[model samples]
Target: MVSGGINEILRAVEFILSKLLSELQSEDENDVEPKTKVRLIVPNGSCGGIICKGCATIRSFIEKSQAGIKISPQDNNYYGLNDRLVTLTGTLDDNKCFNT
Candidate 1:
């Protein structure tokens, strides 16, 4: 269960980073890193909660709340086809994720 949660978080982060990279590509043609605000949200009523290493907070939330991890393909119309554009739609504890 813990491993599964870790994997889910990793996958979500990866997807987010990919989108960020694509967006940054259209900026000025310089080797400068753009500053951006990034947030990770997991359903379990942990919004605004402090984040730490080892993911003890999220792991504990999942274990105690019995929340299930859900992932789906979200279309952003970038590919002009819903099926071709894939993004992560994750929910935990009956709430829409990425709220934070």
Candidate 2:
């Protein structure tokens, strides 16, 4: 369960980094990095999710990343499941990530 959360976060980070790096290689580097988002279907209230320790861990990971990432619970639930949709939006600067 915990590994799944970690994998989700890793995928989001990879997607964002790849996008940022591609922008860096382009001719025009002035454009602001577009906001990136990752959605997940997590357990609902009946499963003690959306506020469980796993969710808290995800929040912590975002906070510690300091990459302008935000995670929030959406209003809608997953299709045909007792799961919820969670969105992880990122506003991290491309230069901050690729200017090394």
TM-score of each predicted structure versus truth? 0.32, 0.40
lDDT of 2 at 38: 50
Which residue pairs show backbone clashes in model 2? none
Q: Write the per-residue lDDT of candidate 2 for residues 1-100, one digit (tens) a residue.
A: 2345866976776676677557654735565655555565665663343345757855554555544433344446556555665665665454343242
Which runs in model 2 stand beyond 4 Å of their true positions?
Answer: 1-28, 45-50, 53-58, 67-80, 92-100
User: Which regions of candidate 1 deviate over 4 angstroms?
Assistant: 1-4, 41-100
> What CA RMSD would candidate 1 show?
14.3
Candidate 1 achieves a global lDDT of 0.42
lDDT of 2: 0.54
What is the lDDT of every predicted structure here? 0.42, 0.54
Model 2 alpha-carbon miss at residue 59, Å: 3.7
Instruction: Report clash pairs, candidate 1.
Output: none
TM-score of 2: 0.40
Q: Name the best candidate (by lDDT).
A: 2
